[model samples]
Target: MLFLAEKRGQGQVLPPNTGDTCSNVTMLDSRPFSVLSTSVKSEIRKALAPDILAFAKATGISREDGFDLDKVRLDALQIPVNNKKNKLYIVHWGDMLFGVNGAIWIVEVNSHKGRNLIAPDEGRNRGRSFSGWGMQTLSSENGSYPELMFASKGYYAGGGAKADAQCVRKVGAFYKINTCPAGCDDNLNSR
Candidate 1:
């Protein structure tokens, strides 16, 4: 549901995003959502197991390890303050989202494995282009955190702007977690 909306393009799907091999990446488009039978969708989801497993195997480890599925406590999945102030991660076992720069692939950010497991760096800056306490504060206020924020910066340890562009170009996913801790304060953000 989330990917579809984000992949629709613009900054999320940034320029120089793809190589010639792959076509445009799409998510949450108007088309895929509409269906006559909810049951059919359910069945399709069920049917996806084998292919998903194959994908996992084809890549290397099984999907179970890659996604960190067991760690996910859907209830406890309250987006953690990994660093950034505002954005939140829609994580399961790992950070999973679709992408396409050369060839589209379902990318996952795994804290379980160090750096080898996830996508190789796109060779951009080690940190974000935008800096300043205000940006960091806004990010925290919004519950958005960089996927692998590094500590080199004052606040954020790992996420960034190019990271976002790269992410969108790689896979049209945008951060979509409501980071406010359920009722303490909902009216803080300026977004």
Candidate 2:
């Protein structure tokens, strides 16, 4: 029993948001509002795990301790970078039992440099970079925190202050720091 509207003159029925990836689609039913089937969720996680783990390794977190599978949460919005060919995967995880609270990690897909991770921290001073725990919540526009993209001027302390905010974006495989002066926000400590 399909309860959708059928256009009188239109010959074909097209689903909305066809331009977007099928991963972002949601099927509505009469039962109740919730996530899709477990199989779909599992596939999403399976596809994301490798990339996320690679990012973890790059950030100095060993693959074994990279991310707790039980705690990992994946965001549905997998959008491509504006003009770049790479896509972004937003993820969230935390060890509530251990009192770690919350943390978000961004994964860049199809990047020439393999995997990239962006972890933001508010307490870190701007214009300087340091590596430690996790990132702070700047925005959750697409269900998950997406502000890691705007944390240009702030410190990015992954792997013991490997690079300043200016060099965070260019970080490649194994946390290799690449220089990109154009992406930097400003030379001053804004935060």
The number of clashing residue pairs in each candidate reads: 26, 6
List residue ranges in candidate 2 displaced over 4 A.
Answer: 1-41, 48-71, 74-77, 81-87, 94-177, 182-188
- Write down the lDDT of every candidate, Cα atoms only: 0.23, 0.32
Residue range 1-191, candidate 2, lDDT tens digits: 11223333221121222221111111111111013234434444554465445445555666365457534543332322343554454333332421322233344544233233433332132211222222222223323212332222133555332212322232222222334334233321222
Whose lDDT is greatest here?
2
lDDT tens readout by residue for model 1, 112-161: 21111122343221111111111111223222333221101121247442
C-alpha TM-score for every candidate: 0.21, 0.30
Q: 64 in model 1: Cα distance from truth in Å?
A: 5.4
Tell me the spans in candidate 1 whose CA falls farther than 4 Å from its real position: 1-38, 63-98, 101-191
